[model samples]
Target: MTATRILLRAIALALLFLPLAGAAAASCGDPATPIARIQGAGDHSPMAGQTVTVEAILSQDSRHQGGFQGFYLQQADHQTDSDPRTSEALFVYTRRSLGEIGDRLRITGTVKEFHGLTELVGIKAMTRCGREPVPAPIVLTLPWPQPPETLENMRVRFEQPLTVIDSHNLGRYGELTLARTDQVNATEYLEPGPSAQLATERQRLQRVVLDDGHRQQQPRPVPWPPGGLTADNTVRAGDRFGQLVGVLDFRFGDWRLQPQATPELLPANPRQPPPARPEQPHLRLVTLNLANYFNGDGDGQGFPTSRGANSQADYEHQHQRLLAALRAPNPDILALTELENDGYGAASSVADLAEALGPSWCVVTTPGADGQDEIRTALLYRSDRVQTSGHAKRLTSGLFRHRGRPPVTQVFRAKNGDTGVRITALHLKSKSCRGATGADQDQQDGQGCYNDRRVRAAEAIVHWLSELPAPDNLAGTLVTGDLNAYAREAPLEVFRSAGFTSMVHQLQPCDARTCPQYTYRYKGARGSLDYALASGSLQPRILTAATWLLNADEPRALAYDGPLDVTSALPWRSSDHNPVITDIRL
Candidate 1:
């Protein structure tokens, strides 16, 4: 054969072998790195900042609008290593949907750690070699047996049912916190100490958030709980869900699940009606924190008041809801907190509420005794049911001069000629740390800020009640309103040290099946901030007491100012704290 003919034959042979060489390089059997090696046993990648080649299958495509601006890549099932400590997956920040799910591809990029997430960015080359089976998701449960970093960026399925522990962020972030079981406030059960600290830590391990896979704020059509969220359809904190399939991820200092498919919601907690009135013929009393019930200048003009409502429309909605809630229990007297400090005029919040109740409802006048705080505790009673005996008194000395709302006390006699009873309405300093100092700051125990102030207020209340002159043969003395303290807190201990007793605890002790009763929920834990404590004389006369599950268990999205429009007249979420209803034989 001629020289030119031989050269042409060699060229043809080289073309045939070119594909074979490319296949060998793309196999990632030799110089290229395994995904598990890059995602070492530690939180970050061992090959961080280094450009290297990797072969994997695309597991998730999330490069659409409102997505995480990336996709997930995981080692094929047959190719992943058996080392359970190391992750066999990574997040590829492509900023574009380059490949379909289950597409096996060879890629060259620099490894980067973005806010604790190991990702591959600045891609230099990418080639779709062939299709591969996506890795099967590993089952996981709360109180994880090992550090979740071991399964970082890998698909996972929850084995046990998860309870919705918190929906506070449901409207803002479209995320719901899920836990192994319902979480109660540590201080509500155990006194603030080493035991409480341990319990708080245990609660942290059992919880994880289920994110909607989007980074947008206030995502439209709140994603979880099957149906879109509405005033009627709500996902409460105690609801349960199962069959959660997602990728374990860490962002914003929380370990969350970016769901692969919709989870199944099991409604363990349903909306309940207000507590029914006891069948026994006894006087009924209710203590409720109005949650800053400011009437915005009381008329129709003032818009955006200091606290409660932002507009006249919002104020009207709040007023209507509060009326519905107060009328449900059919209480003869109301001990209310967080009412607007505006005076007892016809347009005042207290007067408006009392007038709305009926023609016989009357406000217990304090004259010049109300405190300087923007909000004060007020008392109202039905004139036809109970008659006021003496003047109303308030404690303005000591801590109440500035910090706490003054305690208002009054004596009332039943219209049927029964013996007189003394009742005091008081609201203590809140847990807010804004102006807290000295002994009032957070002690890092289960109890929040202002423990000292609350304890002092409790002592003052007990002393003030003792000093006040009472009618001869008084039936009993009852202290009621928002104490701003849980059952096991220092303030409650002070009251217990005295002769006072919790009426609710008398009927439903903490040892019962439901254990500690909660009237408020915060940061995912439930506890009571409102109470009805009776003196030694009144303890035995207490027929029954219950914390009406109206407000705390319901979602804030159903509130007057929330995203929902005007619809039902139900008093589901009239306020942040639920009302405590008690019946007494005066």
Candidate 2:
């Protein structure tokens, strides 16, 4: 007989006795094998390279125009074997043929293991034996009820509420890294090395990403939390939900749940308005990272600049969001990072920002660009509240010139002349690992790369700011901006040793130390990267301080790269870093 005829005859024989799947039976060549037995004992399929028939119900078709080209077949409810440790599901790779969920199908193919996934390929034939009831879902809990290895490809339900610990990829990949509760950044709360190791491991065992099932890039409407993600109704890392039901799938080095439908979430940590005004009539200061504000003359002509908006339209989008965030805190002094290094001319980035902030706001003019960095730190104060008291100074010595955005320090006095405060706006060497070497590379500690450079920059900053002359009537000094180092790192330690009190720790205490309100989220943990540190003279005067949850918690896709996902122009989701707001009597 021909190969096609033999395949057809084999499939015809398998259909005769497949309904008796729980019992041993021989209806096709070499008899039939149980899917659980094929997946027995280890991570690899034991029946690999052998042809066999298995009866299953098609649970989902993961095939589209440009898709996975396969369908998931799971053992029916009535046909499951006695072995509870073995999963009852299998993946059948069929590029040309299609099947629907609930279709009872017996497939005859050669078992194969591709990239750790047990699947059937070289499919000879598939026989539809009519539909049966879908397998009943097994109930489970977060922090995992058991090792998920046995539950691979099986439908499960999570009735326990899961918190949104990390939504970094919600917009990019339609993924949600959820946990039993909001997770903490290890380095933020613990020391860098051995202490962080334990935290990192704990984070790993507790995470499971929820994927949208499609592998395509940039889906217009992100699928999650029942409703599409929006600016006002957005989900953050600390949000929570009551229940989630989906198929547990492992792929690309992570365990993901492909939800049958969108999971409805109860907003545990919802979008918050900007920081409130200080109790008394005092100065409110805000530190923000502009997220690269570059305007290209209202057109897309400028092909490339160092960093920022790609076109004029892109610039407007970035600008509007940034302006909204900057103004939301109702700050008297706005200390900023990541402003374009373009000069203070009419078309300058900082100049345009001042223009949008209304007539009373003014940018403190530097003698020239703050060193040669592509972006510089700046100070913008409301003229109605505070006025520049002295010429701005930039740290040009040591690590500031090469590895960091030079710190910009300017003394500002209240318009009524009650007192003055030295606001030092700093943008430090980033913690990125690109091109790093020696002590700069990841020390394995949770500090990541460039911890050394950031440390040196911090030390230099302390020395430089200490020597500067404080303006007359100055009550205290405040250091604010992106330190680019976490709370437990060497940089903050240097500031601590120099008698600077971290207001973040003061307002929101993590432990004995001041672990400020987190302004940044990375790799599934939330912690502070921006801070407001006050000198001893100013520390006692600080009334209240907090991180305005406008940026870091929001999805990255809401930024200028995509179409305007939000239109209200509020501070929420304006930049990658949340603004640090401090209300001080000084």
Candidate 3:
């Protein structure tokens, strides 16, 4: 054959072999062969024993079975974005050693068709080419678009690693800091003043000692940092530090690198005392159930007209009386139960009380489930004595099962930053006083059912309390309210069984008639129902416990003597039960 004809034959043969070569390259399961890449979603082609390299983003990283840490990487920009298909073509790596969130990784392994979905088997990390670009380090700044309302727990992220070089105060309002790349040639100093003043002052204070012991006096600030922050503008310290090109986090008001990032430790002062062991502050909590603290009929029964309108007048009187009692006791924390739920109209009641007590007193109230129509529980505290460190949690029992009422609870930190206490206030089922002459039979199953429900509530509360971190330093718990269950009732016993020590039991006994321990009176018999119970852990520091019985001096006839007194039978005068108070040293 001629030379040209032979070349033509060779070219045809080359074209025929090209498709086969591409197919071989696409196949990924040969142990001896390195799989360059694999592409497919469904289960039809390259069924099994095919080694392949799949590209995806690390979606989740968690400990897997067989003592391995597994991570799931998912395919990007797929139709799965719309619905169930979003999770298709997923690869699972059952290896504990893996990258973290937002990592773009490639895995080489054999495909195992398990349950109709393709999964990677014996997967190994691969340094594959053609990956997505990693995001640039995030640059943060002060007066940030969404400046954090509070700096106590703020965090920021960046593209590149950075270190804190210097920190300087900006008056009492805040401070500023300078951060730079570890390999930067020049040093950076954070000083108070306008950028120009700061730049100039930084030169003057070139050799200043930093909190972190390291001397970070730099010749001058970088002429132009990433964010318009130079040495000229009087940027707030927080604003300047926030502008640093790295992850920033606010911990208890001080700006620092995030936990995931490298942390810069300030050098300790040799002259300063070694950090002292923190002591739990002594907290005094008094919980009172001001029973129906209203002059007129709160439920619109219209029997207590002699007192005044149930609107503002009744609330004012009760609020005033409560304030007087609070002043007398002078407790640091007060938990009030059976408060009127009069919506915004009744906001004045709490506000007035807070005002009467002083600027140091702070009050937070949660309206009853029925809005402002029912009785609600409230917490009043001396801001100087205690600071609310966490969110408030409301505790409710099974609907109408317990006392036909729900309760609220809150966790607070001592103002001195020493103690943490969880306080719960309750208003349990009250005794029914409907039909029946002034006889014992008229009491019905009110007390019995009330006792049972309270017992259930106590069991639930105990279970919840058990889950809390046990007290480390100070006694860490207290439960108070108008339990409505007398001291000797089964409900009280249930709480006692759950490690609560009743304060009443801790006090001296007195005559049943005129005892300071009696919190409630029915007909002619007086008893103790309002109580304060401390956790078994706090039994040692319980300094004093007693009942104030604010209305004990008033004649019983004066309270229950009104017209509808026969129908509703509730006292028209102040409250039938008095406030229970206690003091504990932490």
Candidate 4:
């Protein structure tokens, strides 16, 4: 017989046995193998690589364009084997779109495991026997009582509330990492040791991704938060939801929930306004990470600079947002990090920013003092509120000579005859592991790469500030900017051991499970990378310290790169890191 005749004969035979398959299914007897038996009680299928016939109900049809190119089959109600240890559902992969949910299907195909998902492919025969009741969705909750593998490919409903811990991939992949509660960085609370190791492992068990059902990237209308995603309407990391009805699917190395019904999201963490200016008469200092402020030649021509904005329009928008944030606190001195490393010329980025802040604002600069890195730390003071007491100093020797950016220190005095207070702006080596070597590489202790270098930098900052000439060292000192280390990390520990108190910690203490205050958010975890640390002599003078919620909590979709996503000209999300404001009575 010809190939086409053989295929037609097989289809006719499949149709001939369709009624028998339905009768056996209704009687809970099978000419087809039981799905649970095929699944077994293990991660891999016991019937893999074997051709088998199965009668099941269609639970999900995903054969449309942008779908998963397949359909899900589950054993009909009251037809499942009495085993909770094995899933009773299987994914049927085929190009043909056939049958609706609740339609009973008798299919013969080779059972195979496709990238960890147990599925049937290369079908030889398929027949829609008749309609059968859809399988009841199994109820599941966070902190799973059983392995997800046992429930894999089954229709499950999560009724307990799940917190949205990570939304970083929401815009790109249409996925959200949800957990039983808000998750924190291990090193943010516990020291790097056995305790931290346990915390990290616990975090892994608590996570499950919520997928948008479609398998495409950057879905047309971003899903979640009930309505589609917009510049102003966002699904932030801290949002909460009570219920989710979906299929438990494992794909791309993560166990995800492909929702059959839209989950209701609650705005647990809402957008907050910029902090109000302090009322008491005091000297306010603000430390901010510019998130790499680079002006292309300080003109409108520099497109696609090394670090920051990619275009002239992007650069202007970033500058405008930053200015709004800077003006909100009405700070007397600004310790800034990640400014362009250009010279102190009239066309420099710092000069342009200073000019924008009015004539009373002037940057503390020494000719040829800025480091050779692409970005540097800077100190800008309000000339009307305080006067420069001594020449600005930069530390260029030791580890900072090549490892980290050189820190700039400037001593300032209140115009009303208050004592001088020296402030040092610092930007340490980041956690990126590219080209890291020896002890500087990630030790896997949760401190990340270049931690040893950052610890050495912290020590150097302490010693360098103490060794400054006469009047510079005589004044009370405040060290502030992005340390690129969490609260309990080794770098911050070095500063604490040196008697420099963390102003934010002194204000609001954190425990092992919860940290309410943070200046940065990464991969859905919140921690303080930007801090205001004060020397022993300066601690008592601090009146209040706060991290304004202008940046970290906001969505990145509102950033400068995507102009259509920019809804407002407000200071929210002006930078990736939030500004830490400190009020001190000098």
Candidate 5:
């Protein structure tokens, strides 16, 4: 053949066997477009709903039965541009396996945005030609950044040791919140306002999630926290982990790290036993959230009455769990919330609990009214240790009637001496944004919903208590209950402004103590939503204020109503909020 004809034949043959779907370098063939261009410097996919060919290395594969049904694809080379606002990766949705990590392959898919995540759907999988080096991860240090837009959908590594601040969805979603250190309430440092806004921003900048590298629901054994979480082997907020390396994924309205592999846990903050009594002569007060204690019926026939237990057996189980928690602390006074608002009639909630605790326990009756609400605050005391010295007082004015459960207070004088303390119990509006409106809506400042209402209710409580006549021999006063506000929240600020100091903060400051400093874990961040604010008089008398890890720290499967093998009558997972115990000398 002629020299030109022979060269043309050789070129045509090479084209036929070149592997069209392979992700070879541009010099070898027509290389696919880089992934960074597809994911622009915004919250959306630049080529949404459009088909595009891209060559990339798979960073994560969660296509297991219950996972995200796909894998994360990131740029394999150091081809990232100087613009720090753009993403270097994207999620590819598919029903089958595409390729393994470092395997370079060309993918043809339609770009789409799912909820808050930018991904590629309708993916056409291709076989791997050869493995390419995975891109180096972005180093995220402590105090991440106010805006993480630039790092979204990118592989990153935690430069600092990140502690698990919240693990509410550990069992359900296999996810937990990680922070530079143990997390705190924004409201605790400053009330919800402009400063609260700044603090909230700081917290957001400091926190990120460490998600189980799965997208499925209810993975039998949660993938994170090392071994599966248990009652005794619980994972608390202060629990620390080694340096983290994962893909930064933004979904469900938050930034999360889909870890490449399970990192070893430090177990620095494990489940702890109830604190021992202090040496000083004092009264032990316990404030617990019942997680919605609803008695089925006065005669135990009311299965699935309204909220809590689903059946008679469930009620019995819940009762046993709560009873264990209340008595385990050996408390002289118990401030409880979310109890069944069944009246003081026979077989009522209080009567049942009081009977279970024997004759020594007596519940303070609130005149003739049990406010018209599904749940209410309650006070119970060991009559042998202290006797009621004044009539019980309940708040009943204005918004307190609707948004706030009327706080109940009573004076208790020590049985053997004149020293006494008055206690007020309240349940404030929750941060849930179900029906939030106006200023009550979440301001996205880290303080959740209903913050404004909680602030207003706190004002009422402070005003009412200021006017309350001190009963005989009262040496101090304590305002304890579920403020439904985190530390530094507006409501908590109101209480602080009214001269009430958070006992937990006074005793165990997060900066000073390695132990966890939170009462509730929501979503994935830990903070003190349940509080025991003491007056100046009571604050000094306090010897210790601590939270018992009966709940929140442990997984939901350990609850009384959870699955059989893990369920029990133990105090673990008794409630959603950890019970706060205060040891004080009146």
Candidate 6:
């Protein structure tokens, strides 16, 4: 017989007995061999529920959920003059204890019948090839030919043809699993079907012909499984679903079958909206980074020291003074830097302030460790004046240095409802080193080494600010912090270049007389380092910017003046640096 005639006869015989084989396999005892070798079964008896082992090349091992892994093994079981019966089987491991991909291993499992399909279960073990992961294959683009009325189950051809082993719907999307040949990787081709007709045609020609000419001429009719599509003819990669000439694997859970090509009705496309949510109205937001509110001696000899009686008594005095200074400004949103751990704990200090300030304020503080308290940068806001939105983000950069906690960022909504703006509070690296020159001098100059970290921090903030979507109304943005770097520093210039306007520009130097804006004092030389900066869009509405010299009148010039009296007296004795305040109108 000619090869084509032999292929046609073998296909006809297999199709006629396939249903009977499945039924017999379904009734076989556990571990019973299913469909014994053609030569081993003299009478062609079906083997079901049998434990059968077959050796073949490992085509693919894909991992899914449940720690369960699956793979496909293919071997040429029967070859004829016309066509070959390539036995492609699916195997699954209930326990995910298999070796890596591309490893050849002997899998022994029970053959089970699933809806007229055969599967290997209870995978015993596997061996590894110890190979590194290969780079993904390059995708092949081809023209799709033969545009059909609708594209359901149509076997369309492509220039880069693929052997379709399985196709099914995972929810609303269609999934196709094809065997990867030397020219293609099976996993890479699992993409959406091509929409272009020319691309489909090019893909169809890429496939290799499976049957001889004689077998192709005398094709056997195969019935569709349940709602399966009819096989009018063989299909290739680029062929339309309904057209014959391409083989398709119909997947239903663990059971799958190679169904002949058939026409399927296309469903209507549903209109959908884009994924973005509607933005909220813009509002004016301000963040204040109050300078070192240390409330301790300049010598760092306050708590746990013999400087004044007991350490606990000194801490109590310091805490009261800190709270008093905080109340004077009464800022809508306050970012307090250099908040001491208070010897008690990070939580205690925050809680004490929240309680003393009443329930209108919320405080977040970082704790300390060892003998030193965790001096953190904190955020305290008036709950009634601002609505907290997102979680606070901690920023770390070269400018901020690795010394203390990173700058914290939080978004707030104005309760007044005029403009909604995002606020960032920062405390850049400080210049406290006594003696140094050159770069060191510049560092001491507030625009050099010390300021370098601050500059980096500022740059980071600028980058973050750039990414935020602009509000529809161009709501003003503010970046307030204890910059350590003076206004003339290049880092400050960087901020200006990035669209920030300084509030200090509106104030005069204190000079001899105690000025309302001088926040720092070194050997009676008063200077301003604390600042409030605004975005260009909101700078014009700044009503007034001034510093309240809370502790300026103290005779001794001590850092803090004991405990603060919240009602009667002001708390200028809290820290060496005074509080800077600003009022703005939208």
Question: Could you estimate the TM-score for every candidate?
Answer: 0.92, 0.90, 0.43, 0.91, 0.82, 0.42
Q: What is the lDDT of residue 162 in candidate 4?
A: 92
User: 1 in model 1: Cα distance from truth in Å?
Assistant: 30
Supply candidate 6's per-residue lDDT for 574. Answer: 52
Candidate of highest TM-score: 1
Candidate 5's displacement at residue 496, Å, is 4.8
Off by over 4 Å in 5: 1-29, 41-45, 48-52, 56-59, 72-99, 108-127, 131-139, 145-155, 395-404, 432-472, 486-500, 508-516, 536-540, 561-565
> Candidate 5 residues 79-105, lDDT tens each?
666567778788888876657877776
1-586 in candidate 1: lDDT tens per residue? 9999999999986764442212234453333577898889898887888877888888877787899988888988888888989998888888655688888878888889989988989887777867778789989888887788888888889999898878888878888888888888787778888888898888877788999989999777877667878777788878998889878888887888888888989998887765666776678888899988988767775678888888888888898899999998888989999999989988888988888889999999887678788899999998888988878899988878765689999887778656777889989888899988899899988777998889888898888788888788698898898888878899999988888888786677662125445689888888788888888887877886788878887777778887665446678888999999988876
User: What tens-digit string does per-residue lDDT give for candidate 2 at 244-355?
Assistant: 7777877777788877766778876667787678677688888888877666542356745558776565666677777777776788889988887877887778888898
Q: Return the TM-score for candidate 3, rounded to 2 decimals.
A: 0.43
Q: Which lDDT value does model 3 have at 251?
A: 25
Q: What's the lDDT for residue 7 in model 5? A: 100
Candidate 6 accuracy as TM-score = 0.42
**Cα-lDDT of candidate 5:** 0.77
Give the whole-model CA lDDT for all candidates, comma-separated: 0.83, 0.77, 0.46, 0.83, 0.77, 0.43
Residue by residue across 14-114, what tens digits does model 4's lDDT show? 86555331223323233677788778899999879887778899997888788898889998878888787999998999987678988899887888998
RMSD of each: 5.2, 5.4, 27.6, 5.6, 4.9, 28.0
**Model 2 regions more than 4 Å off:** 1-31, 64-67, 77-85, 95-100, 231-233, 297-301, 401-403, 511-516, 563-570
TM-score of 4: 0.91
Worst 10 residues of 3 by lDDT: 182-191
Error of 5 at 42 (Å): 4.2
lDDT of 6 by residue, 427-455 (tens): 66666545534454442222334444556
Q: How accurate is candidate 3 locally (lDDT)?
A: 0.46
Better candidate number, 2 or 6, judged by lDDT: 2
